[model samples]
Target: MVIRHGQASFGADNYDKLSDLGHQQSAAVGQALRDMGWVPDRTITGTLTRQKETLASMGFEAGEEHAGFNEYDFQDLLSARYKGDVPDLVKGDRKVHFRTLRETVFQWQADEIENPAESWGTFTGRVESARLAACATGADRVLAVSSGGVIGQLTAASLGAPDKMMMTLNLQIKNTSITKFVFTNSAFFLHEFNATPHMMSGEAAGMLTYS
Candidate 1:
């Protein structure tokens, strides 16, 4: 299971932290997994604070910390794309921000943007390495906590989708949602993508967040 970090401090000075709703969503995920009798024997998380916090909120102790699972810096991408000055509206409004982000990522994938700390190729390679290492543990169930960017790219790659598909996938992946991959015969196959069984019904349904 690969899960996106919960609702983050979007539009804040520090977007690395989880919001209150994020905590609730994480806890709900934990309960939902337990109810399904799908507990994992091993867990891994990106080195980001939000990823670590999400793992904790899900009632799991800290597991392995891998920088390969870390998200590519969107702020850095925007800065590189805009040559350092992003428009105020893009920074302030959620809709505008996402729209701009999608376009920027598209450009980044096409090698149109430059100077980002990590290039598109670098990001993808790192994620692939992380996935391989995580699956190498031979655990029956391995849960990984990561950001949408990493998950999106992984999902797209798994489907043999074009480079631009990651942008679309990234935009729609909900917080704390699970994407399952089965690694066997030295290969990883996608079993599911973007499932939120936890918030399927009841008041928890209102907790779904795509950001």
Candidate 2:
């Protein structure tokens, strides 16, 4: 099962750290996975603090996290895309800026944008490589903890289209959500997308979010 890291501490430069609620969410997910009789043979997580913290909270040691699972720095990508300025508008009025940026991201996914920080071709290639590497480990069940962007990229690849519509659909993937994929001999078959069965209760229900 591929799990996205839980809610992160908002408004922090290092968005890789989980918030108090995020930790609780991670623990809940862990418990749910255990209840489902899913014990992974191996585990992998990004180099980011949040990814590692989430796995640890999930009761997985996941020694020596892999850099292959690490997310591309969107901030750096955005900075480069806009010629290193990353307009104050994005920082000054976050809500509006995010909406605008989301549209731009969608365009990028569609290959409509004239220039993007990282091409969709490159992004998909990296994600595919990571998936191949994970499968090569020959583990029966493997767990990977990563971010929304990475998850979305993989989701799009599984769907065989990394276009704007796919990007928009993937954007709806929530925090701590589980998307299962079966791998054999370097091939990936999607089992599920954005499953949040553990958050059925009221307390846990609040843990649902797409960002």
Candidate 3:
């Protein structure tokens, strides 16, 4: 199973860290997983602080740090293409932000931007490699804490989901949501996507977030 990190410090200078709400969300996820009787035999996370912190908050060791699982740097992509004059969508307005993000991500997929730090092809390759590596562990169940982008890309690639579907999934993914996959011989099949049963009710309801 792969879980997205909790709500990040969106709109902040450093988006790699989580907020207090993020920490609460992570704890709720941990409790949820425990209630579901799911325990990871192996665990991994992206190199980002948010990812690592999420795992730690879940009461699991940060078993591995994989740069391949890191999120594609949207900030870098925006700066590269827009020369730092990004649209207001990224600033605050949630509705407009998603609208613009969807359009911009499609543009990125279409190779509209030049001299990106990592091309779309490279980014996909990295994500695929990371997924394969995680599956190669040969454990019955492995947990990886990553970002929405990486999780969406993995699910999209495994199911042959289209770019638009991937983007939609990415946008809909809630913070600390669980996405499940079953693997056999390095091949993966998606079992679930963007499940947030942990925060469906009670105080956890307020913890639901996407960023």
Candidate 4:
């Protein structure tokens, strides 16, 4: 199972840390997994603080750290693309920010962003490597916590979909949502994508977030 990290301090100075609702989201997903008897035999997370914190908040130990699961540097993407001056539209409002982000990311995927932290090809390659390692593990269930970018590209890779599919997948991924993959000696398939059982009820529905 792969899960997106909980909500982070989006407009705050430090965006790496989780918000109060993020903690609640993480705990809710954990509880949902527990109720369904979906205990993970192995756990992995990206090196980012938000990813690590989300897994910990879910009542799991820090099993391993993998840089391959880390997210693309969005700040750098915006800065580099805009020649180091990100416009207010890219940062001031949530809806506008994401809308601009989608366009910017499409450019990034086309190798248009100048001096980005890493190229789009590099990011996707590393994520694919991480996924292969996870599948090869001799464990029944493995839970991985990561950012939306990584999850999106990984999901696209699994489906043999085009690169642009990552944009759609990335935009829709909710915090702490679960995605399941099935891997055997002969096949690796995506069983589920962006499922949020914990936040599906009327009471928890308000907590749903895509950013």
Candidate 5:
């Protein structure tokens, strides 16, 4: 099972930590997983602070830190593309932010930009490595804590989905959400996508968020 990190300080200078609401969301997710009878034998998380904090909030010790699971740096990508004069559109309009992000990702995937921090192929390949490592443990139940970008790439890789599908998945994944998959020696089959039953009702219902 793959879980997204909680809502981060999106507009802050350092968006690598969870907000107060994020901590509450993480607690809710932990309780929800316990209620669902989830007994994970192994847990994994990205190197990002938010990912590690989310796992800790769930009452789990640090299992492993995988750099491959780290999210692509969008800010750096935009800075490179615009030559350090990144547009201010993402801050004002949510719709514009998503639309612009989608287009930028598409362009990045097409190799239209020169000297990117990491190529789109490289990013996806690392995500695949993270997935492979998660499945290699041979544990019946494995939990992986990561960000939306990594999860989206994993989802797209599982389905052999197109670029647009990856973008869609990335945009749709909610904080503290779960996406399950069945992995075999040959392939990975998606079982569920973007499920946040824990946040479906009550106070947590209003805590559902994506950043």
Candidate 6:
């Protein structure tokens, strides 16, 4: 199962570490996996601090830290595409920023970028390569911590899902959400996407986010 890192601290300059709530969310994911008898034979994570910290919080020390699982820097992509100008539509208002960001991301998914730091082909290729490599290890169940974009690409490719479905799935995945995939001889089969049942009513509801 590929697990996304939990809710990150918002508005922090780093944006790579889990907030206090993030830690709780990570632990909840771990507990859920345990409930399902889904302890991974080999655990892996991207080199990002949030990924690493999420794994640690889950009480599993990841054996291999793989750069292949690392996410393309979206901040860099936005800067490159927009030439460092915050789009007028997203200026000042947090809600507007997120709304515009969602639209911008869909444009990105559709392969529309005015100026790109990395081609979409390149980004997906790297993520696919890493996923294939992890499957090659022959582990019964491998767990990886990654970001939403990478997960969305992998899930979309594996299921042959449409662009609209991909965008919707991307919009729905929350921090610390679980997305499961089954691998057979390096071929991926997606089983579940965005499963988070550990958060109790109000607490879990509070953890929900679109971005």
Q: Least lDDT summed over 10 consecutive residues: which range in candidate 6?
A: 163-172
Listed in order, each prediction's TM-score against the native is 0.98, 0.86, 0.95, 0.97, 0.96, 0.87
> lDDT winner among the candidates?
1
RMSD of 3: 1.4
Please identify which of the two predictions, 4 or 5, would achieve the higher TM-score against the true structure: 4
| RMSD from true fold, candidate 1 | 0.9
Off by over 4 Å in 3: 87-89
Clashing pairs in 4: none
For residues 1-211, write the lDDT of model 6, one tens digit per residue: 8888887755667778888888988888888788878788898888899889999999887778777677666676666567798676555455776666667766776778766777767777888888887888768878899888778878998988875465556666888888888778846788988887776576666766544
Against the true structure, candidate 3 reaches a TM-score of 0.95
Candidate 5 versus the native: TM-score? 0.96
lDDT of 2 by residue, 101-193 (tens): 676676566676555556767776777777777788768989999877777777777778735644565567777899999878847888998
RMSD of each: 0.9, 2.5, 1.4, 1.0, 1.2, 2.4
Q: Can you tell me which runs of candidate 6 are displaced by over 4 Å?
A: 87-94, 109-111, 163-165, 200-205
Candidate that beats the other on lDDT, 2 or 4, i.e. the better one: 4
Ranking by TM-score: 1, 4, 5, 3, 6, 2
Instruction: Report the poorest 10 consecutive residues by lDDT, candidate 2.
Output: 162-171
Give lDDT per model, in order: 0.92, 0.77, 0.86, 0.90, 0.87, 0.77
lDDT of 6 at 80: 58
Clashes of 6: 0
